[model samples]
Target: MLVDFSAPVAASPAEAEAAAVSAEQVGYDGFGAAETKHDVFTTLALVARATERITLQSGIAVAFARNPMTVAVLANDLQLISEGRFRLGLGSQVKPHIERRFAMPWSRPAARMEEFVAAIRAIWHAWATGERLLFRGEFYKHTLMTEFFDPGPNPHGNPPVELAAVGERMTAVAGRVADGLLVHPLTSVAYLTERILPTVREARGGGLDDFTLGLSAMV
Candidate 1:
């Protein structure tokens, strides 16, 4: 089992760096930051510069707040900076937050999330393999990727995407596309086995041997 550490909320960059180093020194397998007051990517960038071995992750970054291209570029940059120690953890917050808090449009979260993930993957594929990006989804489209805008392939390759989901549709999407699933803290083992696992298995059309499940629980 891999142990992970979460950086505290509203922490300064120095504090984030110290937390990451401490987690690494204490032998944690990974360290992550959530999207709260401080930007998740900025905090992780500081941690990436501070530590060398421990994995860096945005524990839950609001996906709808930014477009796929922005996420792909930032994640790729962090992965390169961390020498492949980065994992992009994306979450689609509720509609109210998406509209009122982030001032971003929100609609059909499950379908939008599915398209969002596909778009990011397509962007990375174009960057990595020089493939033409023609991802045209109902919610997002990416038909342009000039070499001037491309960041090129990272020596470490593309970073893995982990999605956080509580609903069945989003969970199925996670199983279908994401490398990992971030389970909500309110989720129970019974629910995971009876609902989440079965749905995920059906979506993937088999066992989940290669997929990682990140569970959160409160005592």
Candidate 2:
């Protein structure tokens, strides 16, 4: 990773959608948006509708800011909107931002994130297979999914969940639960190749052929 001191401007939802349209026209493979100001899902939904071929992802939506059910529904909708090109990227933001800014609880982030992902998949399973939604865990509990609430198995199926992590514990959780790992920009190549990859591989108990890895390069 390299240090970048320049200030970058974030694109508005309309601007991001236009960029996606242009990127798709120019044959870009994927587009991702952060969740700093506007909701990432809102921006991605717009991009999903405006493009046809390019993949879309929520670069790192604050999982601590919202519950698993809401995140699940948002990801599912984005997948539907993108026609199977939506990848759900989630992050457990720091404690201050979670408590002071978002007014959400923050504790044992790694364990919480693992449970969050599990709860989402449980909900998705109930919808996809018409089974009872029974997910109970330490950080979250989701045992109800009425017929009206269930979107009923998304046509594109649920999107792949990617967890954003820089710490050892969270990175291991990503390997155990997430379909991909979103590496932090500050992570060096050595750290990624050594610490991150090893932790993930050990937790996964196999190769990395199917798992996706996304790294943000500073320009």
lDDT of 2 by residue, 1-219 (tens): 211111123778887778778777766678888888788899988888888887888888999999999998899888888899998989998999999999999999999999999999998999999999999999898988888898898888889999999999999999999999999989898999999999999989967867989887675
**Model 2, stretches more than 4 Å misplaced?**
1-9
Q: For model 2, name the residue pairs that clash.
A: none
lDDT of 1 by residue, 51-129 (tens): 9899998889899999999999999999988999999999998998999998999999999999999999999999889
| lDDT for residue 151 in candidate 2, whole number 0-100 | 89
- Point out where model 1 deviates above 4 Å: 217-219
Top candidate when judged by lDDT against the true structure: 1
Best model number under TM-score: 1
